[model samples]
Target: MPTYPAFRIHQDAQGHHAGIEQLPRPTPAAGEVLIRVGWSGVNYKDALAGTGRGKILRTFPLVGGADAAGVVEQSAHPCYQNGEAVVVTGWGLTHDHDGGFAGYLCCPAEWLVPIPDGLDPRRAGIFGTAGLTAALAVHRMLVNGQEPGLGPILVTGASGGVGAMAVAILARLGFSVSAVSGKPELTDWLRHLGAAEVLPREALAGATRPLEKARWGGAVDNVGGELLAQITRTIAPGGNIAAIGLVGGHELHTTVMPFILRGASLLGCNSVDIPYPLRRTLWNHLASDWQPPDLEALVSETVALEGLPPVFEDMLAGRTHGRVLVAL
Candidate 1:
């Protein structure tokens, strides 16, 4: 049997654990394609799955990566051919099925999106799930009528993967961005990603008001709970707020005054279940105009399969910086 290296997660008497191992080659079922993965990325959910905090693994002994870019080694479908470049992300990856951390990947042809022209596999993996989610959030906000002339846009958790991408993309689209983060050390980095201003995390912390001073024209919020409530309250009249993550907390405490009085909108973003065609369209944009000028600056580092465990720990502790790409 053909052999390849993979990072596999296993449960034991001590608890869950993960590491690199040599595995038998994967076979693609009909309608599926087999890819020789060139690069993958570490995500927040992947960190959770690697540990046991988020219950992200529906099956144990699973490969753990949500994003991958590579070349198709074999295909059983008409839409794709051998030696084509492709990307795979979302839709039960690293959860219900084996995922991208392995050297080889097998998934349905429909799950694969062609690596757009001018985009290489490594850069595609750099963007990975984080960039895709950021693009989707921005698209939804614009569709909901967020315009460049609306006023300053706010991005919470602005040092993170999603936050960094959101800031860069929003700035590229011509909106001024006010980035909110607790990490004072990331100020320079946030500005490099195109944030117009940086706000201290305390700015959104422990607020009791149902409504605060209306500040942002619109906002991309990656922190839930009080922060989300703050965004809803502080957003300008007729503005949009894209709600994405729950890193701060899950429980949100606030009145409906902002939504009812200002006509503000709270848009929930779930990138995982997005339709395939829409995801592909986003990839096209990422490779073209929507691609950030400083996309490479967002990557903290690229690690090998064995380095994932420590990286996962740092991510869970909120101690890591931007994206972490895994070199297969």
Candidate 2:
């Protein structure tokens, strides 16, 4: 039997552990495809799961990556054929299912999206989960009436992967983006990614009133604790908040005044398990008009499977920013 290397994670009696291991290569079953994965990327969720710091995987001993783009090596599904390029993110990846941290991935065809025109495997991997989530947030906000004229779009946790992507995409769509990040040294980099202003985390200070002065027209919030609460209190009337992460804290303590009174909408961006139709739409937009001006600038690191542990450690420690591409 042929074998391939994979970054597999486990939580047996010995305790949580993960590392690359040789595993028997799988053949595609009916309604499935075997992809020769060319690229994958690390997200905050990957760091959490790899470090065992968060309860991300319900079942253990699975390959550990959330995003992948590659060419189909074999197909038992009608929608795809051998040599067709494909991309996969979210849908059962890195949870119960083995994910993209391997040389090959055999999965149900439904989970794969044909790599839209204008993007090859490497470029799609750069977008990965972070870019998709950012697109989804923007999509929801737009459907709910978000517009550049509303006010500046405040992207909290602006140095992180999703926040950085949101900043670039929003700027491309002509929104004045204000980025809030704890890393001062990355201020210039964030501005280059198209933020009109790079504010420190404390810039949102004193927004504790039941309703403070409305500043942001809308927001893409990655830090979900007090910062998100602060955004809720200050977003303009009818602004939408796309809540994406909880690295700061999961619990949201705020009043309904932001919703009922101001008509503020808190949109939850669950990149994982997003419906297939919407997923395809978002990918098309990402490849086309909504494409960022500089995808290379959003990437801070690129590493192979062997380098993932250190990258995960640095990412969890807040030593890195933007996207981390995993070249297979």
Candidate 3:
């Protein structure tokens, strides 16, 4: 059997361990596609699972990756054929099933989306789950009545991958974006990416009470602890808050005063397992109207399969920013 490189994670009496190893290439079963994965992206969830810092995987001894962009090498489904470019994110990758950290990804054909006309596999990998989640957040907010005229949009944790993507996408859509990031070193970079202003981590600290002066039109919250609670109080009346990510904390403790008195809406964005139709629509937008002016600007670093371990450590330690691409 031909073998290929994979980032395999294992847990036993020795605890969590992950590194590159070789695995046999698999043939596609019914309704499945085998992809020659060209590129993949690292995410916070990937870091958590790789490092055993969070409960992300249902089982161990599995390949670990959340996003992949590649070309089909074999297909057992009618929708895909050999040499077709595709992307897959969020679904079962790195959760229960073996993921895209290998030289090949054998997944259900339904999990694959044809790469849009404007994007190649590398560019698609840059978007990955981060861009998808950001797109979903914007979609939910727009459907709930978010607009440039409402107020400035606030993007919490703006230096991270999803936050940066949200800032660029929101700016491209003509909304004045106020990015909240603790990394002051990237303030100019954030401004270049279309943030009208960059605020420090302490900016929202004043919103400690049940309610504060409503300053934001809406918010894309990537940090889901007290910051989410604070956003509930500060969002404008009739505004929508797209809640995504739980890096800060998962538990939510907030009164219903904002919803009852201000008509504020908190929309949950689950990028994982989104319906296929909406997934196609979001990718189309990312390729065109909602596409960022500089997709290349979001790339923080690029590494091969052997280089993923240190990247995961940096990501979990809050030292990494923007998108990290893994070239297979």
> In model 2, what lDDT does residue 35 have?
94
lDDT of each: 0.89, 0.94, 0.94
lDDT of 2 by residue, 1-328 (tens): 9999899999999899999999998989899999999999999889999989989998988999999899999999898989999999998999999999999999999999999998899999999999999999999999999999999999999999999999999999999999999999998999999999999888898888889999999999999998899999999999999999888899988999999999999999999998999999999999999998788999898999999999999999999999999999
Clashes of each: 0, 0, 0
Model 2: residue 44 alpha-carbon error in angstroms: 1.0
Better of 1 and 3 by lDDT: 3
lDDT of 3: 0.94
Which 10 residues in a row give candidate 2 its minimum summed lDDT? 201-210
Candidate 1 vs. true structure, TM-score: 0.97
TM-score for each of the candidates: 0.97, 0.98, 0.98
Model 1's lDDT to the true fold?
0.89
Output the TM-score of candidate 2. 0.98
lDDT (tens digit, per residue) of candidate 1 on 120-198: 9999998888999999999899889998676799999888889988999898888999999889999999899899999
